[model samples]
Target chain A: MPAPIEFYFDFSSPYGYLAAQEVEGVGRRQGREVVWKPFLLGAVFKTTGSAPLLDIPMKGDYAKRDMDRSARRIGVPFQLPTPFPFSAVAPARAFYWLADQNTMAAKDLAMALFHAAFGQGHDISAPDAVAKTAAMHGHDPAAVRAAHDDPAVKQRLKDEVQAAQDKGVFGSPFLLVDGEPFWGHDRLGDAEAWAKTGGW
Target chain B: MPAPIEFYFDFSSPYGYLAAQEVEGVGRRQGREVVWKPFLLGAVFKTTGSAPLLDIPMKGDYAKRDMDRSARRIGVPFQLPTPFPFSAVAPARAFYWLADQNTMAAKDLAMALFHAAFGQGHDISAPDAVAKTAAMHGHDPAAVRAAHDDPAVKQRLKDEVQAAQDKGVFGSPFLLVDGEPFWGHDRLGDAEAWAKTGGW
Candidate 1:
């Protein structure tokens, strides 16, 4: 079988939330399976020496406008979550914990977390919030909450983030086809084309 | 007449070079004239606290690859100029000088400079090099060279950069359709759509 498309994202990223809604369809069209990997953008930012998009001067204002415009263009319900860019550790750890059991359920839990954070403007930074979202997806709430602090789960997230940095991922909504990297939500079309044609 | 699309770019930016090749076609399709405003990204970067793409760490390496890949994907011949991120002052000044006389000729000259700098990978930082390129378009080489050092020409570029910052332009290939702002080369299509449909 051909290699799967690695879909890397951060739970706090608005563009990542937007791309998640469509990446499955992109993979489906090309008969490829998408492996969802939620990593910490904050850690990547430290290596890149970059700040959050909304922290820049003029670019920040434009980004705020673009996020809303991009969401509307894609027909996704979006509102900048209050306490913008909350820590994504809770959701990310939960994703890896469940992913160890069932990849499909992990994806469902990821979408649930993304929807609650961006789609409904809920904060998924807290362990309880993340656990509640996972519980809705048939996960045990107590187990899910405990997973956030589990040593193995935390190590998994740290290793995944390091691997992402090693692979040169510097932004949210990054995708990889085979070993080729495509960054940003806008590049999803290009990524799909690359997968379909095996690079142009 | 409807407001024309404002196309802003920097000569040193690879993505700006790529977008310069296609922005005019987008404007033509929507029955709108494109106004090319070449400005100093270096000056704008100061306010935004951003650096050149290839100067950043891991992102720099990925950008080098993406520049080549994006160029090939769009069928445009591209090479990161020998001295990547060269000063754009000379060519920008020459542009404003010519634009003051004939907007059409100025547009042609802008493309010619872009082609020489990015398409052919020539160093365009010096006034003499800019003059040589301008001469190919029937401009007097000495007059074009002198224009680069003229105080009024220098002020025009400075004012343009200031105006761009005021309008929240923090990156190359930034487009304004009516009043809606779109950044990056990938957004050219979205800008065209907005112009055609008066926005979605």
Candidate 2:
């Protein structure tokens, strides 16, 4: 079997949310498992010395419009969460904690959290909101909330962020197919092509 | 006739070169004229407080790889010119000077210059080189070289750059169809769709 497609994202990223909605279809079509790895974009931004897209001059306004247009084009419901670019600590921690038990369940929880954050404009940055979203996916709300403060879960997220940096993933919705990195939600097609053809 | 598609680009941007090769076709397919506007990205970068893609930390490395992969995928020969991200003042000035007389011929010169700078790895940043490339397309070498220093032509480029910034153009290969902005070469399809459907 081919290597799994490593899908790296941050919970606060709109593009990441959009890609999460579509990446699995690409994975299923190509006979590859999509490993959903959620990390902290705030942490990644700090290490890269980059600011959030909505904070940059000129480009920020354009990004807002582009994100809306992109989501619309893909037939996905999207709205920028209030107090956006919030610390994704709660959601990231919940993902790793759930991932330790059931990978698929963790992916489902990630999607639920993403939908709550971007689709419904809920602030998943809050532990309560993240736990509520996880609860909707059949996970224990109290346990998921507790996972946010678990020492091992927090370190797991930190290590994953470090691993992403070590692998040179500096952007959300970053995909790795056999260690070939493709960044941006726009490059999903190229990533799938690379996965299918094993590079041109 | 519908409003023409405005193709904004910088000479030194690799994606701009790739987009230049493809944007005209998009315009043709959509039955719209593509007005190629060569502006100084350096000026745009100043206002946007952005750095060259090849000068950024991790993004720089990924950009190099993505550029090659994107070029290969599109079947275009591409090589990063020596001293890339060089001053495109000469080329931008020459384009405006020629554009005043013949827009089509100016576009031809722009494409030739793009080919020289990216396809052949020649430094079209130099006035002499720009003149030589223009001369091959039936322009007078001396006239083309003189236009680079022409005060009116220089001012024209400056005005164009300012206009682009005013329109919120903060990146290379930005396409505007009926005033809707689409940045990046990957968005050529989006731009074309918008032009065809008058937006969704």
Give TM per candidate. 0.98, 0.98
What are the clashing pairs of model 1?
none
lDDT of 1 by residue, A121-189 (tens): 998999999989888878899999888889999999999999988888889999999999999998898
Residue pairs that clash (backbone atoms under 3 angstroms), model 2: none
| Cα lDDT of model 2 by residue, A110-182, tens digit | 8888888889898888899888888877778999888888898889989999898889999999999999999
How good is model 1 by TM-score? Answer: 0.98
The TM-scores, chain A only, for the candidates as listed are 0.98, 0.97
Tens digit per residue, CA lDDT, model 2, B1-200: 99999999998889999999899899889999999988878767776678778888899899999999999999999999998878888888999999999999999999999899899999988899998898899999999988888888888998999898888888999999999999999888889999999997
Model 2 TM-score? 0.98
* Cα lDDT tens digits for candidate 1, B82-125: 78779999999999999999999999998898889888999998
Report the TM-score for the A-chain of model 2.
0.97
